[model samples]
Target: MSSAFGATEKSTRQVSTLRRFLRYVRPYRKQVPIALLCVLIGAASQAVGPFFIGWSIDNLIAQGNLQGLLLALLALTTIYVLGIQAIREQIVRVGWIVQHVLAQLRQDIFTKVQSLPLSYFDRSEAGDLMSRLLNDVSTVNQAFGQTIAQMLGNLFSLIGIIIAMLSINLQLGLVSNFVVPLMILTTALFSRWARSRFRVTRKTIGELSTKLEEDIGSVREAQAFNRVQLNIDEFDQLNAANRDANIEAVAITAAFLPSIDFLNTLATAGVLAYGGYLAVSGQATVGVVTAFLIYVQQFFRPIQILSQFYTQAQSALAGLERIFSLLDEPSQLNDAPNAIEMPPIQGEVKFQNVAFGYTPNQRVLNQVNLLAKPGQTIALVGATGAGKSTIINLILRFYDVTEGAVLIDGIDVRSVTQASLRRQIGIVLQDTVLFSGTVAENIAFGRPDATHAEIESAAQIANVHELITTLPKGYSTYLGERGAMLSQGQRQLISIARAVLIQPRILILDEATSSIDTRTEALVQDAIARLLQNRTSFVIAHRLSTVTQADQVLVVQGGQIVEHGTHQELLDQQGIYANLYALQLGSTTPVNTAP
Candidate 1:
């Protein structure tokens, strides 16, 4: 009883996924019935063509009537021509529909990926997620682009052939089709086995794609460390696993397909033997026997194709399962039903006894409280893994607080729409990210409607105006692959210019100058200083220069604020902040605190 219940549940899930998939095709509903009609008409023509042969042989040939034979030939040709056209129409129409459905699915998947929480990406591989977007969706495309139309045509043809056979001679047909039950049983058993195997293949292929993307992205590191051989061996394991999965799928097909052919051969022998017996005993005619032979061969062909379609459907369904799984991933951070758009910011930011953790068992920030009135810069200085970044994440509402609240201008951050909140905040990270576009466009990323003159003004404010003018195309110059053409300082300038153009009320510079040389750091610092003016700002950095003049400095340790004061006041106390300041300035003071 338990097994039966499990099977029923499994069947229900498969149906659910299929129904979900069909919704993508529902927009093209009008075209679908037309395609199916073409399939039906094609099958009818294919099924009827055989009867003419039997009629011609019986009435025309046996009676030596040349005119009737010629007319039968003409009729048969016309029937087949119609079948050919209908089949072609169905293929073209369905292919168009499949491409469009796959396109929509991919667009929706990408949109979902963007809305997913940072925590989801924290635990998942970029490569694996990309595989669902490209590889898995492509699998569904390959399967359904050709399979659906052809599968329907084969099914209709099979049904028509069975009817024609039974109407011709019920007893002979019944005897000949004795292997039909065995064919179904064989197809069913093999398809059931193949479904799980193909599912494994889908996963293994995705894993392989993940490894490929990771290795390719880090090829420079591998070569720098002389670990190319190590990477090769690791990649080989994933590659071998993918190969074996596919080989098993091919092996199943090899074994299963031949069994269909073997059954068809057996059925043919039975039909020829019994039909001959009936003809000799005057229970059937010579032409009837001839047509039975033709129909018998034609019958197994559709069965074989349908069996092949079933196996392919298993693979397509597996791909669909993966795609749907991605689509079904919850956006753990969504707006409240009562959420309202955030008003224009005065940027009096506050973290009120906030507590948060990526997981429930581990808290990264505990009872963290802070306030920054509009237009003050707060520097968060801490050791690595010391909850400094978690506070910043809360400010951006990247993750909702596990407890307490974050507010902007006394309004709860979660109570406002995320888009509205984020638009008013600007971020520049240690590694500057720029898309492949003009220097002007990178700066105007947050404000796509910004005029070219406005872009130049922002660049001038960030002290990058001269650099842009020096580039071959000035502001129109293309920045390729995260602005690879630019130096580290240049990238930061572009990033700062982006922040400047937005004029965000709250600005975050997260180690924004960490990677540059002293000279470049100075330029980035100068740009950051200008960008930070007249905003409630948060700065997290490993360097002291960015923090030395902060209006307020908070020393974080063990997920709690150990000290908070102005830079000189913290230095005067000689506490955790003093020790960090001493270490970075090349002194030998040490401090320890409770975890």
Candidate 2:
């Protein structure tokens, strides 16, 4: 009894939430009215059949009228077939419109996800986002497609049946209605508890999905580290939690259903007893009593439907909450009102006294300044986490500097459109990402309209044309996701080729050759030379060989440029760059004068 009492209290809260959830359906009011009209017609057909039977029993049989009986049977058959067809057509059409509306909603969600900045991704969990995109959207789809129409239609049917029953005989109708309010009150109370349990189930399912994705993606790592059992245990725990939540939700519904069924039986018993008394007293006709019985049955059919709708609506409410939450999230960053398209760039890059951090009070770059004149190649060398990548990110406007300015062509980068800025720059990163497509497709990703000849030329300049030809399909070979079908060195070469194919005014090489063998690196040196010619470039690498080729080398320490000069000039100074050079060279060599 205590457990049942607690369940009732919890169910009350769920009913309130479900009521709030219905607000999302307000925009579809016009279609809803037509659909309801169809439902009402269908429900009216149910009561119509009972009247025909009553007429046959009380009049047709007494008069021995064979023609009237045949006509009534034919009419009943026609109404059943035609009404069912009409109802089906309306239901299917409503479903089609709802599906179309859902597609637009899904596209809106995906667009919002893409438009958000990097910081949003940095702070958000991949699994949580996936839940909203996949699970939540699906939940809402089911809700809109089925629940909304049924809820309103069942409600109207229930009301119509009650009115028809009273018109037949008021005392019997009143007796049948006695248990309805009780059933409704019980359901209203239990629904709140059921919804909370369902919400827990939904949340658990999302966590499980996220964990499964992570585990599969890192199966090798898990096995190698002997953590597979640990992961399995965690998954089992989540699965168990999800199971309990679902069972609890099912239990609430199961218990309430039996109580409602008992109440309905009690109503039917009262109608039978009272109608029989009225019949004996000659106060009501036997035909009227018979029709009233059918009406009572019809009345409860919609009640049962309403009970099921309550369960479905609860699940939909949970989905709506998650969907709205995702839509409510603020974008990582937005353009200023005065932001304008950047002018044609000459690729003169400047960072003046820049300070930045991924989060507040944790500086990554502090008081950092650098300059690259048009057609100059600057190399930045540092230990890991010395802010080399942060500088590149700032330059590309993947992130903005916390203080000061990043200027391109003497204009502040923040003052211009990021898309315009990026179109003029090309990047090759250490972890090369290639989409699943032919070599030509990957090379043309940055410039989708590039000619076939242009793609071959870029591959040739990158010195990978010969290797690509060696493959069975040459440039047409389909690379797997992230170019997993190719070797790391081969993927890096493709990335470099892609960058060169873009032919941007500015190029960024952030350890572009870090994954390749020395032979391939040496072979690609000329390609790098051709790629850098007359283009402003920032190259981040620890390899002394690559650093020495730069017009200027900047040795960054603790987010500041501690030393800056040509290779020989820096070696003469015997500072951070010289020490780093000697460390890689294994022995210090005499500094040679610049050419």
Candidate 3:
């Protein structure tokens, strides 16, 4: 959780972050000028109202100029009504523009997330990314919709009042502004503190969201292990931290507004005392003194509003910092500058002296070499984390090799666009993933434009067409998240159907049948045999029975291929493969050592 905050350290590109944010406002360029005009009109109108009131007090009330007073009152009422309407119009237009800007921002963030490398996801939590997408983006929206307009409007109002005050009486105007410096000082100090606290609050909220998502997704596991109370205690601790951070932020805000109010009170008193002295000395009229008092109040009101906007502005900037930080992360995998689109492949894959590690100085695959001629089955058998999956990752170019190259038809995978390289390969993992959609849609995922006949054909080839017919809506039936509504075997069959639809030149089955029952395995095996008929295939299996017919079996251990031969040939060698095969069959006979 602390690491999450550490990751959001104030970026050096803060100015660029703001510049990019302003670019979002560019689309609303025409509307913005009109909106700001409305704001200006509203501020000027409000500033003139106090003059009309003072004129009526001095002329109509004191000198009994009834007609003049009625004219002044009418003018004040009209100005007040127009000002309200102008501000309302500004709000409506700004709201529309703000909504569009937020929509565009969210779309950009989502697209960037898609382009990021797999390693980024391996190190990031889904909840944290989602928080940025939802919560942080919404905060930025507030900056545009509420904070920006308020800041601008109040700024115009502040300027208008200052000018009106100075025009009426120079002495009182100068006195009224005595508190301006004090207010600025107060705001500067509090805002600095508030910004730091609000950043922590936002980061804490993200961490809490991440924890909640993780715990809820694994609730069943927690219950099975009887760790429910422990989970609750942990959540309570995070909740308390979030609450404390928020309270501290509130405390800073709580101190800020009142300090402004207190200064405002002192300034108002100064205006009254000075203006009364002027009225007594005949240096200023009663009406002018009264109007100056009203103008003073008007002056501080915007300052007060501006102070509050400052807090919201800080929060929005914090969110912007986080969002831009994410956008700044360069993808670990990228094609070379001169890379070309991979031509349609014949599926001859070779790993020549390949080596890799997720981190420096820690190799996961070491000096590995292997070859799969066109339309051949290469079986990789090893214990978990013995580099079986790493080989598949290299074949798909998910990660670049630390040394040497992976080639398809003698062209380095790194020299081809990833999309083009991956388009020719199909993969089915041990855990099949199906999105929330109709059975037909899942099968057609790799080819959305695939016709009904093509979809059914793929399903029939995977041996799941009969199962689809049994569903209430056949191919149109809705499968819930990850296809939870279907049996595991049914889901695996659908995944295979998806791969079959792609008609990929190279196919990878990583422990594809390890979790199914013997009956389902037999059915899947038959489908796989048909699917592998003419495609280059890589089969990784814990169940050696699945790899018995492979054209070549590579026994991998500790990031190296210890043996490579036909299944019968490896059994004759009586090495690791022979021992592993015997153990799976519940045989205890000691096999002869290859050494």
Q: Which lDDT values do the candidates have, in the order given? A: 0.89, 0.82, 0.88
* Per-residue alpha-carbon lDDT of candidate 3 for residues 1-595, written as tens digits (9 for 90 to 100): 7854643443334456778888988978999889999999889987888877777787788988888877877888899999988888878887888888888888988988998988899899988898899989888887667667766777898899889888888888899889888887888689778888888978987899899999998999999999999999999999999899989988999999899989989999998999899999999889988888888788888888888878877788888888878888886588899989999999899989999998887898999999999999999999999999999999998899999899899999999999898888999899899999999999999899999999999999999999999999999999978898998888999999999999999999999998888888887998999999989999999999899999999999999998999999999988999999998999878676747
Could you tell me the C-alpha RMSD of candidate 2 in Å? 4.4
Instruction: TM-score for candidate 3, please give it.
Output: 0.96
Error of 1 at 396 (Å): 0.9
Write down the TM-score of every candidate: 0.97, 0.89, 0.96
Q: For residue 175, what is the lDDT in candidate 1?
A: 80
Model 1 earns a TM-score of 0.97
What lDDT would candidate 1 get against the real structure?
Answer: 0.89
Give candidate 1 misplaced runs (Cα > 4 Å). 1-9, 588-595
Which candidate wins on TM-score? 1
Error of 1 at 230 (Å): 0.6
Query: Per-residue alpha-carbon lDDT of model 2 for 1-595, expressed as tens digits?
Result: 9988877765565466555545444677677677767877766666576766776767776688989988878998987776576567567756866776677667767888987778888877677778878887788777767765665556766777777777767888898799877986898778777778778978987888888878988899999999999999999999899899889988998987888778878888887899889989998878877877777787777788788777777777787667766777886456677999888789899899999999998998999888899999999998999999899999988888899999888899888888888888999988889999998999999999999899999999888899899987999999978788888888888888999898889999999888788888875677888999999999999787887878889888898888898989998887777777877888756434334
Candidate 1 weakest ten by summed lDDT: 586-595
lDDT of 1 by residue, 307-372 (tens): 888888888888889989888899858899999999999989988999999899999999989999
**Can you tell me which runs of candidate 2 are displaced by over 4 Å?**
1-36, 61-64, 146-152, 586-595
TM-score of model 2 vs. true structure: 0.89
- List the pairs of residues colliding in candidate 2: 10-192, 10-193, 11-192, 11-193, 14-192
